[model samples]
Target: MSVAAPPPSETTIADSAQNPSMNDLVTEQLVSSGDAASFAPRTALALLHYDVASTILTDLTPNELLNFALTCRSICNVVIPRYIWAHIALTPKHPRLQVITLLRKIAFSVECGPHFIRHLEVASIHVKKPYLKCRNPWYLPYLFQELFTQMQNLRSLSIIHCDKMLPHLPRIPKAIVSLPHLRSLHLANFSYLALNLLDKLSGLQTISLASPTYNVHEFLSSTTSALQKILVNSRHTLEEIRLFEVCLNVDLIPSHHGSRADADTNQELCWPHVHTLELPQCIGDGWAPALHIAFPSVRTFASPEQSHWWTAALRDASFLTGLESLHTKSSVARGFTMAGYTTRRLVIGDDMPFDVTNTPLKDLLPRHLVNLQVSLWSSYFDPTLERFTTVLPMVTPHLKYFFMRMNRGFICNTYHNQLCDIVDDIRTLPLEYLCITWDVNCGKKRCDRCVRRSCPEPVAKYVERRLPSLQALTIRVDENRRWHWKKKKVEEDGVPAGTLSLMSPTREGDILREEYAKRIV
Candidate 1:
């Protein structure tokens, strides 16, 4: 029986968390007192050259990178010279003093280190008072100003949960305008008054506004004018916008004394380069941008609800001529299908317990769809095996990319014939990339029937034989593990020849479903 390993214990977790970086392992001893830089040729860590190791180290967190640097002098030198802190993600859960210390180091660094930091994400930086002994009233403002002003070369900045930070660090708006290289900005939980810098900063490429915890009506109404001004100023350079729970009021900004528009009327503006837009669900909500704006180059559109566009360009155009993909819920997808709207790429992620529109796909799906992504996170009481039975066969055989996340009982582990039947259904797809993550219940189950027949390998083999154009296959049998099969070979490590890969709950994030969609505009 080939069984995956059980979950890790507390001691094993404590030991593994200390050495998290995937940088080439440092050779503790070069076997000589004077040759600390050299490694034995036979060592596995010796395989990666210095440049590759340095590049890989950039992926580590600030703390992890520092810990890895402490291993040896050679690695310490590498960390000091390179742009290892190009990306920094800070959350309230992180040690406050440690983060402040790192920020201070970057601000005063002699390596021009602050210039190398391209992306910064500060999430939920509000209301969590630090327990530090230094109780100076001006401490946060000074620290933030020093750190932010020195990051003049930053490319992307994401600041969320900062409604309280404004009271302490009001100079952040000025600091944002000081960056010449900044193009992407993400803000959440801020008032319209906080967005005055939007007019001062132009040439932005991406803007994402989210208000997860605020009143929708109040936030939207307050931010509409500021949002419109920013859009008009950055029209030439803006390429993507993602709005969550903050939709612009469809009416034009009521004339203010010295606003950008003239005398209660404005000229039409066109976003000639905007390629992707993700708006929140807009089903029965009564707000659509009333501005005379056009997104002529929008290639991908995602909204969770039905939409009614009143913009002159959208209303006049026969269809979204440039749109290649549509992402929405099952009910909205059905509405689009019923309205005769079709696209080559489609994504349906409806997390409803019972959706009547879900069955419409059983009878018809867009025949020309080249890429399909479906999320069946239905109730655990009801497995999506039935939906799979109906929809998988309907997908075009010529489709190239397919992604699905579903909860099916360990029927594959207990009933081989049912697994074979499921594989036979989707076998005709000439899929170049296929990803499936089977969502299992949290409860325990035991498969005592000598495990090879109870595992997913036989099903994968059956799939590989049935689909000739298959290029890459990834299957996550349970939450903790996934394996890839290519060229008739399965990358199953640390298990018997009969078993799949050992379940590494300690590894990293879920590898099953993150890569199915293209992100960049």
Candidate 2:
């Protein structure tokens, strides 16, 4: 029997080796198959337990990071500790109950509630109802106190109160007064209670008070001592203060004759480190001297387009010595010559009419200006290329950035002619960047022609040919409500190569291509 079995040929053995049993095939498939749970452990996710993985996770969006953590238990352990819930914004558009419930859910996490939140903004929509008021003022203060109590790392807080609810809200709670890390506070349409909160926050570096409900003079009168205390405590840390539409009363400061008491009192209230002061139009002449005395180190001042504050500052040579930036209208710029003002940056509003013939751009701008922005309503009477040519030589020594915005209606052929001439003159300046935007309504009758002519190719070519120091140029033309924009970068050889272009109503690309071909021909 053994000899007969050994007689099995090589073919028979080979056939047996080529074929496998059904149980063996099923076992092999079971061993190789993997689900989400098995795949996650075998991938790079196992490395998440290391510190290096947290750095990569920090770049992911909040929702994306949360979804990733939900994939498996191992990933959740590593992601939860690395996630930072830094910014939280709540608006009235969201259901009140839903927002509150979500906030409560976040606060329930003991480890994240206090350590993660950094910036919090709460804004309510402005609703004008005849007889129904949905806002409960009592609920707002309680909610603020509860949230502030839980968020220990909050640095910036913005609260926009409803106009109808401002008068009924309670005083700022003690919870807000004791935040050690809070540096910025923005309060819009707030009541007198905000002053109490402000008094205790001496470590704040940036404070913006906008559209206060109470009279400015009365509010300052009640908190003069507290204000003095804050100045003494935060003088070194406070850098920026913005007051929008809130009047400043000079009478709040105790003025003494040239006696030791005056020196001692001034020393206690001086803000020696404040560099930026944004004033409202309500600030009067009396407030100017007080501001000069209080904030002697201020170098940048931002005011309304027509406020007389800049005029008052201009008269004080001592105050104007350190002034570096002026944000005002062109009308205001016209009254003051550039001879004495040391301002290096000027931002002019578009509402004013700048007559190049009358004002002469050379005289309107300071010699030391490094940045100039002229936002004007250009028309037939706007500045000409000759005026720019004349002025460029005078200011080119220091001017590095120029932004010109022309907002007009019905831009005719003359406008483009003037634009080409201006480009010819721009080639001579050592500008670092130039941005020109034309916002106009090209009638349907001329959209096709205007779109072709407004290619900005001529301007780009001019810059490439003449301007050697120019780095970047941006030109935007809006025709019949459609936007067309192009940006170019000047290479080391001084030729501007097209970097980016966007044309709406996508079919315009074909028209632009045809225009380019014709120009080449």
Candidate 3:
């Protein structure tokens, strides 16, 4: 006690030499007998009995689940569930023959038979190289029919990019028409087959057709009566229709007396339950006045292309007046006044010109907008950021979420002070969520000030000081150094107010840039 007992380390070693403890005896027994029970209880098996663990296993991908099942015997028993093999995708890049063989094996497996495939996608079909080759080119059709007939529970089907199958239009498989539970269908670049398929499926709730090679105007004219019958049959169940890079003629719609009469007397065909309509920008001007008449209940309208037709449609007094969400290019939105429009969410593309005068943000944006997403394609300069700041006060009162995505080479030369200033300006607004994403350039000649690791410090401090109402803030510097700032209202102090994590870099270039903003919170 007087000399601290020669320190605990030295005393412990001396005491151990005199008398070994229970731990030492157990180690000796384990080494001599090679028995696992001498150390600890078999608690790993207990994890399989937990509900939380089962929920986690359900979230794993198909390949990951397979790997986890093979890790040990106990996990394999818990991992083999029918829901894990419900969705199957077969693409062109991989060997289709091998994939089909595997699918056939899974379909007839004694343990998990038949009803395994609920959603099936045959994507990237290159007409040049059919999935199955033989002396008879029509063999693939029969094979597809057989596969579809076997999967009785198939509910969703997608066939895309089959341009080379135009010559085999009539020979396309018809098994899809007989699916009792098929609720959704997506077809692209297969005009004849798509029309034929639509004529057969009367219970579909969702239909998406894109860039059909057939002349839409001529086809509609020739099959106006059949199209009317299909529309009438699906009026009760159809809820969404997406048309991309194609124009629909309004005159072809069946009307009272089978003729176009005065607006007061003419009764247009209407889908009472349909609320979502996605139209291409190339839709004709004659279709503008008939939009609301045809879809009186439409609430969400999207223009997926960059064309002036959507702007023209918005100008019509008879166009859809109850739209709650709109997706359009910034260029098309210029010179349009959405003051009377009730749209609450707006998504603007990045292809707008840099000049703010051409596409005035404050004038074009609706006052009721609660969520705003803007894309910036400016590779070398970010002129839109400064212009957007000028209009923040106008949208500050109602806006709740703001998301901005910038393309490559956009933030390589930006300094910490610029980010701090932007955050300071944003703090004046009452935003609940904010997300900013840009590609980080790590080239050799990059600016030293820009590459400094403490770039996000000032921005984080500003949010902590100026924006007390902020709930969540996320900033990504490419695939690495993603900074997240979240407020925990229940905690008082000592806990970190924000967190910055460094993650491994992901895929490169345009594709990665598009996906960077979509990472989980």
Which number leads on TM-score?
1
What tens-digit string does per-residue lDDT give for candidate 3 at 383-422?
4444555556565457767776655434445644555555
Give the range where candidate 1 is weakest over 10 consecutive residues by summed lDDT: 1-10
Q: Which candidate do you rate higher for TM-score, 1 or 3?
A: 1
On a 0 to 100 scale, what is the lDDT of residue 270 in model 2?
A: 67
Model 3 stretches astray by more than 4 angstroms: 1-56, 66-86, 91-130, 133-147, 162-173, 217-221, 224-232, 250-259, 262-268, 304-320, 331-339, 353-360, 377-386, 407-415, 439-466, 476-521
Q: Total backbone clashes of model 2?
A: 0
Instruction: Give Cα-based local distance difference scores for all models.
Output: 0.52, 0.51, 0.51
Across 164-271, the per-residue lDDT of candidate 2 in tens digits comes to 333334333354566677778676675565454556567878876667676656645455533334445666788887777654543123332122446776666667
Ranking by TM-score: 1, 3, 2
- lDDT by residue for model 1 (208-300), tens: 777634444665544445666777677799999777665444312221212254533433355668788777653234444322235667888
lDDT, model 3: 0.51
